[model samples]
Target: MYCNQPPEKPGNKKELLEKITNMARANSLWVTAYGTGCGAIELRPLHTSRFDMERFGIAMRPTPRQADVLIISGYLATKTLKRVIRVYEQMQDPKYIVALGSCTINGGMYFDSYNTLNVLDKYLPVDVYVMGCMPRPEAIIDGFSLLMQKIKDGRAQGWKHYKENLDYYRENQKKIITDWDLPDYNW
Candidate 1:
């Protein structure tokens, strides 16, 4: 798509290019790694010096509020769904969600499992979907690049999108299993 990408402003193509290049070099991406499954094991290379995502302005953060990107790495069970929504809501505006595996995209092997959600998009808006049983470090880096472009252009309207669809989300949230549903076997 960059072959003949249009300039941000007709009179200052060079300036636009520079702005994009700078963002790329800033290592400015703040990621909250929500590792939910075995797929998270693949994130090791991205965090380590081998892939060194730090070079792309993408680094892990401890809190969602401090994050600009939320990486859903692996399958999410029904019990974890609520926590995911809470965390996603806590993030600052313009945040992006990256589904890091086939399991997250379609539940992979857990498609038939009652506890596994079919797709992360069912609960959260996903900006980029990385397809693999587990995506490689390079794929993750590429996803980061895509996300940076979106952030730079101010196209990720997470807050507005969620607010408009709050009721739909609330109804979906209600369908998920709860602790109250567990039978009182101990009793």
Candidate 2:
């Protein structure tokens, strides 16, 4: 969707153009750098000047509420998996979750581990899956570029669908963890 502006006055073309540009920039697309596992370490280069993800108009956001994309970097333990759901819930509409590593895709090295969840999709809907034990910086950049294209084409699902599946997601989350499951250390 194009950026909307209030009615333009006779003398405000320059200001209007500036506003439109900024609005387009703001709405173009934004991603939240949600690094849940070891693959997160590789995100460093993607954000650096060398790879320079910003040049493609993909800016990293600090909070999920304002973000349009959430990058789940690597493995998800029961503990961290629960938090990922919470963060995903907080994000605004039109959000996408990209699973970064094979771990996130299918548990990678933790395929048989009890603490790790085998597949992120079992808990959340993943839009893009990048396959690698620890994907190189270029792969992350490539994934971001592909995701941006999908966003521009209006192919990405908005958060409303996620909201609709809230109960389903909650049920899946229940398979992971709860405060009652924690061990008591009191003496």
Alpha carbon RMSD to native, model 2 = 9.3
lDDT of 1 by residue, 1-187 (tens): 2213322332565768756754653348788878877778888888787898877767889898888777788898888877777787777755678888888888898899989999777677888778887788788778777776766665555545655666566667767845433222210
What lDDT does the true structure give each of the candidates? Answer: 0.72, 0.72
Query: How well does candidate 2 match the true structure in TM-score terms?
Result: 0.77
TM-score of each: 0.77, 0.77
Candidate 1 clashing pairs, residues 3+ apart or interchain: 27-57, 28-57
Candidate 2 worst ten-residue window by lDDT: 1-10
Candidate 2 ranges with C-alpha deviation above 4 Å: 1-27, 180-187
Q: Pick the candidate with the highest TM-score.
A: 1
lDDT of 1: 0.72
- Residue pairs clashing, model 2: 94-159
